[model samples]
Target chain A: MSDNISSSRLTDIDGWGRSESLRSIARRSFQFFYDNYFRVEWEGLEKIPDDGGALLVSNHAGAIPMDAPIIMHGVEQHLGRPVYGLADHFFRQIPVVGTMWSRLGGVPAHPDNAYRLLRDEHQLALVFPEGTKGTSKVFTQRYRLRRFGRGGFVEIAMKAGVPVIPIAVVGSEETMPILFKINSLAKATGLPYFPITANWLMFGPILGTAISLPAKFKLRVLDPVHFNVPPDQDRYSKSRIMDESESIRLTIQENLYDMLAHRGNPWLG
Target chain B: MGRRVLLTGLGTFWGGKVAQSLEKHPDVDVIVGMDVTEPIVELERTEYVRADETYSILSRIVDATQVDTIVHTFLVVDSTQMKTKRLHEINVIGTMNLLAAAGCAGTPVRRVVVKSSGMVYGCTGRDPLWFLEETPRTDPPETTIEDSLVSAEGYLRDFAQDNPHVSVTLLRFSNVLGNDISTPFTETLSRGIAPSIFGFDPQLQFIDEDDVVSAIEFATSANVPGIYNVAGDGLIPWSEVAKICGASNLPLPPFGTEAAASILRKMGLVKFPPEILQLLRFGRGIDNSRFKDLGFSYKYSSLGAVERFAKTKRLSKAIGIPRSPYTYDKDVESFFHHSPSVVRSTQSDSTSDTF
Candidate 1:
């Protein structure tokens, strides 16, 4: 594009998701942690298509849900295209995090917004179907996948006619390994659960168990599953969509198990 | 077919302008202007009739003139001119009176074009990015002005349904900004320090003043009959708009804005209503494709309209510093080049320099 045309197009952007200036700043800030702290070793970088829309379905973990950002950063670093993550409605209710998430290209996981991102903008979208259930699991249940919510992601991908790329990250489950969930305290604090973890209990208040263990992250991008149907086809009924969603869930779960068996230690990738 | 038009709200700028334009139109044979106040502008052929909305004179004028089109441009946008309650009366009650008079049995009015506002789509935390023409009206509107507009729309919907013969075109215009027009939105922008809710930059849409007139003209002339969202081409964030207007921002927390609103109201700087605050926090944008499809296009985009409005001498006082001729990005680029470090390097070795 000519410089004049590109500059005019830049001005036309209404600062919705992915503000060029703010995204660059946020990318630099997050890159520090991704490179130094977790030291993420990502595989299947070539699985992502160069252009058009794609959906990344990953398992949710870590009490704070850092997997999405890690995946977002990894894809952006490798593919030169920013990935918009679908945050739960709860994120939008919070004061600062909600606004920050929006500015950082995290759209609330509403059907309207999802459709807009996937179909209208033709941008990659990341969704964690396991939700809080997968994140707040106890230590015994770590690496064991939770039930994917109603397969909304499948319906969305079907409607938008985008390929579903299942992603499996091995290390996030060890970040803030919860011993047990205290539902009573969780109710009082308005959080999903109050997790009692080793580092959190050991380290006292303020800097307590909130600190995530420096676990080496190993992320694998699985093969892209295309429906091979018409973009506007309604043949993929609700049940069919649910079944496809379950199959995608199973694919991620099997990959998690395979990754855990092959890995020597969780701390060392 | 030629039109015998009855133009309401002749005293206001839009009313006078519409009446003056209609007077010159070859298709329009008779122009009857109705308002309690006289027209502000000079007109040769237009007939000015003085009457309150509640009086029977409106119905009598409709019956006597046999006007086929009634252009209702009487919506009150600025609350500074009249008390809120009186503005409500002029807006809601006045609309009711005119609709009742025009839609009466055996009335000669076959078409009605009422200028509603986009404020009916309330600016809230849960608003869609762009409201379409078919978007449901905001129930129990966020502000008193919105409530009046909603009520007027409800009445229009009912009238359209009841009187199938009459074509009622509801023009839901975005916040209008023009050289001559002075609304609360314009005043807010022209303030010394425009206050916005901190950390929230809502996307706002605007319509040029001339475009509003042209839209009115289109509605009055064309056979299009439906609710339409009338706005300019693009949307701009309120912060970017503030930058364009050369006005500094005074960011206040959501809870703290109320006190600042009181101060603004006390100083007569703004009509700082809750809706305005909400609008500042979550600005409104609407889709105007349907209006374009109706064969009318806007002359200016939202930012262009605001830029034109900002150039007026009346707003120049509030805009103490004139907007830079260069774009914001260009200014940023020059700022780095002119900085001490870059300036020293470029001044010393001008050959291989990339700042």
Candidate 2:
């Protein structure tokens, strides 16, 4: 309702890879939790470019991945434009969830899709460099950043010539804190890792960890960092891309620690 | 002396139209229309030759008419309209006949124009976004129809190589859509409920019937050598076309759609051959720059051709009522306004370019 574009102008939000109808339906269903349950607090949205493409690099957590949708909702609500989330290739390999994820503008994390979203379509893209490693981190390692994958995100941003906005999302780690991870059985179920959570084993799976804990969410959007790399440069050059990736990672890690220090308890934001 | 043209497949609707157009041309001194069956419509300045497109008969006709220009329009776009075996004979064996006759000593056929379809570049997941004229024909004959066309083109290439006097021009067209043309594509669009592959919407290219006629006429009038991909400007996703046609999209899983299509075929609900299912799932696209380089311009863009088809369907009271006089969804319009495939091909010269 706060959007400058009229309802008539918003007819069928379907783009190349984004289906507006399904995205809105999923957003509405998730908004109930984003607003009432987690009570998400969004900040620094004006940093996102009003037009043209940009990348939002966020930290991934929560075994169930409520953070991605929450971030997407926050960006959509504040920016009044859609955000395409890049997911792991494994996410699209899953059955019903894969279709739902794609319909909600979750593109496979292939370099081609990333390049097209950012450079070609000129749409906001949300990426988690930490990937599955960040999601499967145990409770003891909460808020600890993992090695961002080979700096592929940096290379994509470099090739696209778009600014990267660092986002640190709090409370995603406590939603369904994993105590143990079982990798042997994960292969059978097509899951990356089978996390044994206190809420799932002790409390019923349906009423427990499956339902994310009501920990308040703080989504902090940092300043945008612009990069200028020649489009034809070899993307595999580690010295340039890795350094950029490490810097972005350090920024998110510092922001995470800052937000954690200010908060009184892990249970309350 | 003015040009004397011999047009094959005059019995077919397209051939008849080409003959009628050439009949009115003052430069064409003689127009000989050849086909085994009688044409449905008769033209004033054209002479009909009742002979099959075999080597012996075609060579005799060539000797008798002494025609300098040959326009071959016999490629059967839809094989279901005729018997499958006869369709094979007409499309494959008939092409071999034309090639042999054109290469015969003192044939006088200096210019050859053959009408082909874009299906030669098979629609597969591995296909490049836009198939250039030089893209190797990688569609290994999956069906009898594909085999026929592939062999026909091969024979044409051989004939052109063996006989240097004849300049062969092959115009590989995308799916032709017009109210008068009853192709499998048009049949699907005309239905109230069109079945599509679930969760997959591939980009489709089209040429209007009028543009096709003009292209053939232009090719016959001029001597443009070598093969060219003849497609109209712009590309539209299949879903957008379905929306513009006001057909309720019935998305069917690939595995289930085959079984359903077979059953529907029995009930007369579906007319497309089973091989066409692959094209429905992954559509074919072609680059039309080679066609434009030949000094011919297309009046109707792919979007315009579709709108014109929809309008004709509306006026003829054939298809369901559209939501409005067909305008594309704004989002789709903006998405393809600057086509990523076209722009990327021009903007970047790297292998990592994404289309």
Candidate 3:
């Protein structure tokens, strides 16, 4: 029954499940958040290469983690290249959210996905090394980077033969601060952690859970870290992966502190 | 000597298709096909051997035929068609017996190609965007069909390890959509409204049935050993797939999806088995580059496969398909094989292999 049909594509969706039409619409709508709501400011944007693959490592924060979309929108608008945002698999557990996420270029942070996006396709990819631990932290732990996931991101960049460009983000932690967490509710709902965020308390249940505080966002791109070792090996030295991962984390952490130190107010950059 | 090949499940659609394709190869001197029932399609030179569902007589047939290549296309991937125990017997025990026959001391079989489904990966929200051949499923198999396939693949891995001389190639194919094949996806799309989970538009990958057959043939002929993933290039949203099929979706409530599916099943509108249900929620994509790297080029992409099916479906609906559904005749087949009155021609017949 399989007959040949030439030129059958109907949508602009790519193999990564990213649709340029949807991405453009999302970017246009999100432009407000970048310009007015959070008034995002950028530094060292040129550090991100104009072409070829590079892993954009950043400090993840906020209960909803707005850094991902912001970073994706900024790069695509300025550099004219699509950035594949790699996030936790948990986002996929949701129905509408997961579908919209994928169409807007959200990919599960699987090593295979990273390797394919970076090494094979030679496209830009953005990843959060700290994963859930970074986004789920409480207000007290704001700006303090969490431990990277055993340096898996480092190993992936090394394997893909791509340089790791660390980006430090400020004010995301204050966007929707985690006041406290309810472990029982989290366990019941199968969530990593359920937090009673500041947004919820300040704006009632609907707005609090859905919206982030208008905290001015400032971003800085660090130097791209390139591993001297050869790429595409069956295995690499574990010690080297850990060392590279920790150094990258420290670099982002220190830069975050520097960016925060320069800012006098959270809401007013 | 020309290549002698043995095919499993000649009565099934895949088995019959593979046999017809194999008959076209001039180098293939002998084609022996075994199945529980008579072959579905008529064959010119291929010999059909009737065997039980488990293929109890596989060893004797293997020894007698001394076929060099074995194409195991009998695995029942669809769970809705049979009971769990029967599926286990056909998938697990059947594979065990076939492997035993192929691995026996001084066995003639040196190449084996097992056509497996991507259900072995077990769709989950945690799965990677594209599953490489070696990538493990995020969670273990929850459904009976997945469990059976996993166990059968385990045996193949062990057999390959024990019998290093034999080249074992396992092709895990993603969801299939063809003009004649009626999978869960097709069944739903053909109905009044395809059932989809509310608010979920999972991205899926599909391959044309032609690609599936050619892949099996390529595996039998090529020396490339080990496992490889097979599917058309790219992923398409389930919504886009429905649009291509010109079918509207009946979004089942996200909560209590199972209960809704059961009610629909009782209505006999469509079959939403566990695998299909999970796939509807979180569709799957397998990395086909490994197979493509070996010079395999697919005739259709994911969208192309769905588009082809939609075109054929619309045509059939408009003119009431002219297909007569071929039925095998033993007398005519035997007469063609043994009758001295019959004439053999150099050119292949055009009537056969036309789905």
> By lDDT, who's the top model here?
3
The DockQ score of candidate 1 comes to 0.10
DockQ (CA atoms), all models: 0.10, 0.05, 0.70
Give, for candidate 1 chain A, the lowest lDDT window spanning 10 residues: A1-10
Interface RMSD of each: 4.4, 7.1, 1.4
Name every residue pair that clashes in candidate 2: none
TM-score of chain A, every prediction, order shown: 0.90, 0.91, 0.97
| lDDT per residue as tens, model 2, A1-269 | 13221212112424333578877787788888888899898778788888899999999998786789899998887778989898875654443465556567877676766776788779999999999999999989999999999999989988887889999999999888899898887988868898887678667777665688778899899999887666635454779788989999999999999998888766666
TM-scores of chain B alone in all candidate structures, in the order given: 0.85, 0.86, 0.96
Q: What are the per-residue Cα lDDT tens digits for candidate 3 across A1-269?
A: 44556546778888877899999999999998799998999999999999999999999998888898889999999999999999888877787888788889988888888999999999999999888899899999999999988888888888899999999999889999999999999999999889999999999889898888999989998999999778899888999999999999999999988888889889998
For model 2, the stretches where C-alpha displacement exceeds 4 angstroms are A1-32, A41-44, A55-64, A86-103, A106-121, A127-210, A215-267, B1-175, B189-191, B197-207, B214-255, B274-311, B314-355
- Which is the better candidate, 1 or 2, if ranked by DockQ? 1
RMSD of 3: 2.4
Error of 1 at B168 (Å): 2.9
Best by DockQ: 3
Candidate 1 lDDT over A1-269, as tens digits, reads 12121113324334353465677788889888888778899889799988999989999987766788799888987888978888766665455565677667776676556766777778899998988888898888888889899888887887888899999998888877788888999999888788887667767645655577888899999999997766655446878888888999999999999988999878877
Better of 2 and 3 by lDDT: 3
Clashing pairs in 1: A200-A209
- Where does the lowest 10-residue lDDT sum fall in candidate 3 chain B? B346-355
Tens-place lDDT digits, model 2, residues B162-260:
988788899899888887678887887787556677756656788998889899999998888899888887667677777766767877675567888
lDDT of 1 at A159: 81
